[model samples]
Each structure stands twice: as C-alpha cells, then as structure tokens.
Target: MSLSTVQQVLARIYTDSKLRDDFLTNPDVVGISFGLNCQEIQQLSKLSRQQVDLFARSLKRKRLGEIRKLLPLTNQALGKEFNPLFFQYSETYLPTGNKKHLLDAIAFTKFLLQQLTTDNTQPVSVLDVLRYEAVRLKMFEGKRLLFCNRFYYHLETLINSLHSDSPLIPYPQPNIGIWFRLPNSQWRSLFIPFSVKRKKIFSFHRLVQKYLAIQ
Candidate 1:
C-alpha cells in the first residue's frame, strides 16, 4: 500500500468529477488503475459518495470564488453563463503550480474566448472585454509597468453598459487600451485613439497628472 499513490488517487477523486464517478461506480477497477492494492481500494471505497460529492462541490465553489475576484468585470458581464461555462472548463482542466489561481484565470479567459469564437452567440465586445481582463491579470502578476491592447469597441461605454445592464450597443470605436501601475502601486487604465501618434508629442506624465487631479 503506497501511501503517496493512495493520496494522489484521493486528490484526483476529490477534484476530478469524472474520475470520482468512475471510482464510486467501480472502486476496485479504478483503484487498480491507480496502482492501489485490495486493502487500499476497500478503504477508499468506504468513503461516502454523498460526502465526496459535497467536498467536490465545495472545492468548485472555492475555485469559482477565486475566479470571480480575479475577473469581477468579466464575471459580471457573463452573468448566468459564467458558472456553467466555468463548470465545463473545470471538468477538463485543473491548474497546478505556485500561481495556480493566476494560471487558472489566464487559462479560463482563453477558454472563454475560444468558446465565444466557436459559438458566435456572444457580442464581439465580450471577447474584447475578456482579453482586456486577461491582460490586466498578467500585468499585475508580473508587476509590469505598462500593458496595451487594441479594443474594437469603446471600453468605457462597454464597461458602463455591463455595470448598468443596459443594451450592449457599443459602436466600432477602435482604440488602444493602456494599463499602467503608479509609483505608489495603484493601477490605472485608460484608452487612446489610434490617431494619437508618437510624432504628436503627447505627454503621458501630463495625462497621468490630469487624470489624478480629476480623480
């Protein structure tokens, strides 16, 4: 009876729903596949299915909570679709590493983008919003000073619509959205039109100062 192997199987059974179901259905077979002997299999088989399911649900809720904190705007925008989509994502993927939450967020953002791309049911603005949030996550994780990405719709208008539950009628106002961290470690985000060229001698410091003054 390898304690480490049994622990590994238990971890998967707790986190992976399909494996949990299979184990509950045929514990001996599943245990054998995991290199568990007869005694270990019998011991694991004694675990109550209802209790295992409750623990798994709790784990999923924790993961969902972390994702909501990391991507509040995206979660708010998705509304009813968020939970189901995350459930689908969790079925196939389990993030690992020191920055597992961050990794999970980045992977989920890409998954959402792929899902929306294939379905074509969601507004195009949603795709941009997901990308914007993903960039923010990466920026904060890396402590990057600046990150920029192109957005097809007016970001401010889209964000406002999401907040208000108004119709998402964002026009095709393309621009570069910029996210920067201040010296005090506060983050700020804004957009600039593509028309703003380097040759125009725009003062970023002045812009930041003015934005701070207004705030």
Candidate 2:
C-alpha cells in the first residue's frame, strides 16, 4: 500500500473509536479492509494494543490542550461541562484540512453558533469572546492585516456593540480587549474590562509596530 493509505488508516484508527476498537480487537481484518497486503497486515497486527491506544489518547489530549489555549475563557465558563461537551462536539464535528489550533477553534465557534440557532437557546457570551479571539488570531493574510486599518479606526463601534442594551450582547461583556499578546510572546487574557482611550487605539498600534519591531 502507498504511504498515504497507511497514513489515512492510521489517522482513522487514531480518531475513530469504533474503528480503533475493531482494529484493536483484530488488526488483520481491519488492515486488509484498509487495503494493506498480507505483510503489512501482519506487521500492523504485531504492534501491541497499548501503543495504539496511547497514540489515540495522545491525539485527544493534544487536541484538548490546543482548545484550552485557544478558548480558555470558554472552557472555564463551561466548568465541568467542557469536557463532556468537547467529547460530543468532537465526535460530531471532526476537524480536517488545517493542523492549526486556531482553525480548530474556528470550527468549535461555528459548532456553538449552530447549536444555539438549532436550540433557540440563550446566547452564551463566551462564544462571542472565542469568535473574537479567533478572528484576531486569523488577522494576517499573506503578511497584511485582514481588516488592515479599518478595525483600529472603529474600536468605538465594536466596543459599543458589546455594551448595547440589546440582549444580543454576551453577558458580562468586557469593555476591553480580553486577550492581548504580551511582550514575552505569551498570551495574556483578562476578563475584566480595562480602560482604553479611543484616540490612542490607532497611535498605540503604530507605536507597537515601530518599537516592538513586530506585529
């Protein structure tokens, strides 16, 4: 079999529990079904179950780790419900194509939005925060900011929506940018709104670009 086929089979084994269970129970049959020849099947069957299980578990752990980093507030807001929700959400919506964690977050945000629409339930503000961060992370497209100078010029309008009397805004909507990239190259997030001068928004952005030597 081709290397791509092997990768696909291994990937399925890692992601699909039912298929992994079947493979663990009898690798020979699963391997044959995956188009592996007798030698390949035998070699695969020789691999112990524990190794396969560990690999599968590691993938889940890594995914959750990424989710925790990308959606820290959302994870904390859900509390004990986060893990179970991730279990159900991940099974139903297996992310593909992009290995970037931000892409996974974008997918999760979509899932949350759809779930809310389908259930017609109260909106969760954490999802809004997650969407905002995801967009911020996806800001650059081919070395140019996606929104360019537009967002810097419109901080007031964006902040206004967060504080609107309408129920559309997330509860406990913060008045400040909740997440910021610190100088040490770490993600620093604050739940409380911090004071920001609208006039400084554009100037500060320019100053950061010039002094920090990064964007």
Candidate 3:
C-alpha cells in the first residue's frame, strides 16, 4: 500500500505538540482532519499515546544531551533556565546542516538570545556566556572570528565565570576576545594582550595537530 499519506500525517504528529496531544486523546477524530482516510485512521488510532509520549520525551532528552556536549558552559550557566528555552527551540526550529549537533547548539543559543531580548529580559550573564560560547564553537570548528579588539577583558571574565552561579562582572573598559579549543579538548580563551599574531598562528597550528592526532 502507498505510505505517503500516512507519512505526512506522522510528520505533523512529530512537529505539532498540540496535534500530538489531541491525537493522543482522540486519534479517531483527530486523524480525520490530518488527511487520514478510514484505513489510515484505523491504523494510526491504534497508536498508543503513552508510548508515543515516552518516545518523544526520550528524543528531547537525547537532543539536550547533544547540546550539552557541544555547549557545556552555556548549559551550566543557564542552570534551570536552559530547559524551557531548549524545549521551545527544539519544537519550533528544525536545523538543516551537515554539522548537525554543532549547528543546532549554535542555533539554540541564538534562539535563546532572541527570546530573552524579545521578553525585555534583565541583564543575564547566561546570555553573555551563550554569545561567547556560540562564537567560540564556530572557532572550535576552524572558523576565523574577528572582533572590535576592545571586548577582550569582558570575554575573559565571561569565560571564567561560566561555571559559576553568578552574573558576570562587566569589565571597566570595552574589550575583545579570541577563543579556541586546546589540545586537551578543553576551551582556552585568549585576549590580544597575550594573543599576539605569533600566538594566534601557534594556537591554530595546535588545532591542526590535535585533529591529526585524533585521526
């Protein structure tokens, strides 16, 4: 039998939370509205909402796990604030990129930043941490990032404060920042004072060495 119609209905099931709930409560009626014919309705109505919810929750947890692996500092800095934002983000945005988790993590950070600003949020260090990490993650993937050369000190305090449960103390002056992963798979942030041209080249060389070593 042709499965395309059922497949489309199932796609909606996964993407629409409200539809999922309605379908869970009354698949017989709900399936009718989703292009499901009598046979399709009969087959889909047999689906167990309990099992579906369990699987959905598992998928959510797994996605969060992937984000945590990529953005450890941002995850920790937000504490409980991370969950709701992540949930909304995952439900609303479907990422399309080759570097799936990395791209998703970066997109999630941007999503949170947009929401916070939209809500007229108070000064949140967590947002700062996320902005920092998102850029750093790009650098970690070998992308070159240039900044105003003034946000240096602020970046230092932000990176240092990621694991702390307090807001970042903004530095007195405007600052600049550059960050890359170390050989140990640990993040290392460097400012212009210490991140000279030679140091920057050396740091990138180390990135290649680590990649080669891993291979």
**TM-score of each model, paired residue for residue:** 0.76, 0.57, 0.63
lDDT of each model, Cα atoms only? 0.83, 0.59, 0.67
Q: How accurate is candidate 3 locally (lDDT)?
A: 0.67
| Top-scoring candidate (lDDT) | 1
For candidate 2, give the lDDT of residue 22.
93
Model 3, 89-198: lDDT tens per residue? Answer: 98876554578678788788778879887886635555666677777667655655432222334555776765465555655333344454545466555444444243
Model 1 residue 154 CA deviation in Å: 1.2
Which regions of candidate 1 deviate over 4 angstroms?
1-5, 143-148, 161-169, 178-215
Task: Give the lDDT ranking, best first.
Answer: 1, 3, 2
Two-way lDDT contest, 2 vs 3, winner:
3
Sliding window of 10 residues with minimal summed lDDT for model 2: 144-153
Query: Can you write out model 2's per-residue Cα lDDT over 31-80, one digit (the tens) per residue?
Result: 98888998777777776778988887888878888888777655654557
lDDT string, candidate 1, 1-115, tens digits: 6787788788799889989999999999999998888999999999999989998999889999999999888897787999999999987778778898998998899899899
- Pitting candidate 2 against candidate 3, the one with the higher TM-score is 3
- Choose the strongest candidate by TM-score: 1
Q: List RMSD in Å for every model shown.
A: 4.7, 9.3, 7.7
Clash count list over all predictions? 0, 0, 7
Clashing pairs in 1: none
Q: Which of the two, 1 or 3, has more lDDT?
A: 1
